[model samples]
Each structure stands twice: as C-alpha cells, then as structure tokens.
Target: MRRDEVQVTLLYVFDELESDLGGTVSMREHSQVPESVTTIRDELRDSDFQVEALIAEGNPADMIVGVAADRDVDHIVVGGRQRSPAGKVIFGSVTQSVILDSDVPVTVVSVDAEGEGGDRP
Candidate 1:
C-alpha cells in the first residue's frame, strides 16, 4: 500500500443458516459479536489499523463480496486453510468463493492450524 493510502479492515459477521419463522422469532440473538471477532478487531485497533465492524446474516461469500463492492474497497484479504481441490468441494470454502467471485483485487493468506481455525475473522 502507498503511504497516502489507508486500509480499513471490515469485519463482517455472517449467520448463514438463520431463519425467522413467520416473524414469530426474533433475530436479535444473532447480532452478538463473537469473542474471536472482537479479539481480532481489538488486535487491529491496537496495531493502529483503521477498522470497521459489521454484523450481518446471510451467505458468507455473498456478504463479503457485497461489502467490498459497496464500499469500493481497493483490495480484499482472506485467510484460508490448505486443502486439496476435492476437500474444497466437500467442505466448502468461503475464501475460494470470495476470491473467484469478487471483481476487486484479492489476497489470500494461509491460516494457522496450530490451535483452532474457527478463530479466523
């Protein structure tokens, strides 16, 4: 990035399978931010990076791409675990979807599997 350029990390939380049964149930419960997401946001803030956090409920890939488009983001960075092509098909991959589907430039970083991959934000 150039010295004049600024990067704002957009933390988007997506609850894909949520459903409101004929408006009988409230979806406010899904608004809660995960601890891991908060941790990442805190870390980025501490590191002095511009950060914007948003909570949304929808297909993860679609939301990610939508945010990038809506915000006119210059670049997108996503973390992913190493996997074979067959593994990707079977397990499904949000990283793959965003990279292939997005019109903006995308950078993919490998995730560390030391403790848990769930902590990726």
Candidate 2:
C-alpha cells in the first residue's frame, strides 16, 4: 500500500507508579511518551502517512480497546510479552481481551531484543 494510504497510531502503555517507585525496578522506567512510539513516529514522519502517539492510563487491554473504538482505527497494534504456561492459564492474556472485544482488527506484535518475531534472548 502507498504511504499516503497508511494511517497509524502507536500506543505505549506504562505503569503510573513506575517513576515514583524508582530504585531497583526490574524494568526500566519508561517515559509518558514512550521511546518506541517516538522512534516509530520519527521513522514515519518523512512518509506520507499520518502517525500519532498515544500514552494511556489504566489496564492495558481496556485502554487499547477503548482507544480503538474511540478513534475508529483500522487496526490496533500492541506489543505482547511472552508468558509462561502457568501465567497464561492463571491471568488470562491481555491480547486475548483486545482481540475479543475490539470492533476493529487487532495486530498483536511480540517484542524481543532482536526485534519483532524473535524469541527473548
């Protein structure tokens, strides 16, 4: 598809208290405007597509679904974390919720050090 025809919005979700609880958190504290979204926006800026970055609060799955409905997005892209078999069964998956509830198509992207599609190193 033509770049002009591509309209995309990147949503980055972060815990609200990550910054405040700083001092040895397992995950690095991310910005309100996430770096990944910024990188994507920068990469797409030269293209003809329209790109937006959204940072939201509350449960990740719920926020994603709500935004997808509110914005009427063609597709919702989310970064997924690989879960242990036990975790998957116990907590249920966030992506599953979005896939089930979204009015629009949802694209779940798994992230890793090597990039999308690669397993965690």
The candidate scoring highest on lDDT is 1
Give TM per candidate.
Answer: 0.69, 0.69
Clashes per candidate, residues 3 or more apart or on different chains:
0, 0
TM-score of 2: 0.69
Residue 39 error, candidate 1, Å: 1.9
lDDT of each: 0.72, 0.71
Candidate 2: stretches off by over 4 Å: 16-33, 113-121
lDDT string, candidate 1, 74-107, tens digits = 8998767788899988878889899899998898
Q: Encode model 2's per-residue lDDT on 2-113: one tens digit a residue.
A: 8877878777655333346574332324444545667668878776678887766656688788888888888877677788899989877888888998888777788764
Ten-residue region with minimum lDDT total, candidate 1: 18-27
